[model samples]
Target: MEKTAFYTVKQIPPEETYPVRHPVLRTGLPLATCEFDGDDAPTTFHIGVYIEGKLAGVVTILENAHSRFDEERQFQLRGMAVLEEFQKQGLGQVLVREAEKEVERRGGYFMWMNARKVAVRFYEKLGYIIDGDEFIIETVGPHYVMCKKWK
Candidate 1:
């Protein structure tokens, strides 16, 4: 891991996530495609990982429940993105870990996401588990529900 002053993770406004999300998560789609529901909700928060002062990754967490999870206070992890040039340098893992801490701090008992099939192993490395069968998301390809909890 590149553990140096070059990296910083902090809370940011939803708009700040677009720059990273558009390319990393929605490359061929319009930038507006990156916008998601509940993005500006009172309980939603966005986190950005910067490399030498440039945004290198982003993630969003919002209050939502998954029927499979019995936990009353649940948060959904969404729009996680790491620029292609920065992949494998551990930024994606850092983004998710920070989001996990923030959610637990806010009283969330668990969190989940529709993880892309290609990234399933990545989330598993961070202690997230596949919760269901894989399904296709129209323009996004295959995905599997994954969940994790720290409370």
Candidate 2:
């Protein structure tokens, strides 16, 4: 899909991300389940991609370390989602790149996430590497720990 000038990406409050999260990531689950840990922490931040002034995608970043990473400064990327109509149009990539920039600005050396199995390739395309075996999170189905270290 061709890029559009109407698309914009920026930092937004964590709450602003919940709408997309609930529908895309937590379908059939309680909206509260879409709220992630450290979402309100001072060191955490959310990014939203807007198309024509309407938010079409969102991602949250937390200052948390993955057990397999030794970096003292790490950010966990979570609750990333784009509206179904916006999927495959490059909005997810825009959201991720925005989150990575924020993590780097915050002095983080690495960024990790429990990426859903189906979305693994999406993360890989953005330079994230799988770190361990895939596992299920009770209600969340299969996921793999993926990480990207700034070089």
Q: Write the per-residue lDDT of candidate 2 for residues 33-66, one digit (tens) a residue.
A: 9878799999998888889889899999999877
* Candidate 1 displacement at residue 24 in angstroms: 1.2
Please report, in order, the local distance difference test score of every candidate based on alpha carbons: 0.89, 0.88
For model 1, which pairs clash?
Answer: none
Identify the runs in model 1 with alpha carbons over 4 angstroms from their true place.
1-4
Off by over 4 Å in 2: 1-4
Clash counts per candidate, in order, are 0, 0
- Provide the lDDT at 63 for model 2: 92
Model 1, range 1-151, lDDT digits (tens) per residue? 2246769888999989999999888989998998999999999999989888888999999999888889888899999999988888988888888888888788776889999999999999999999989999999899999998774
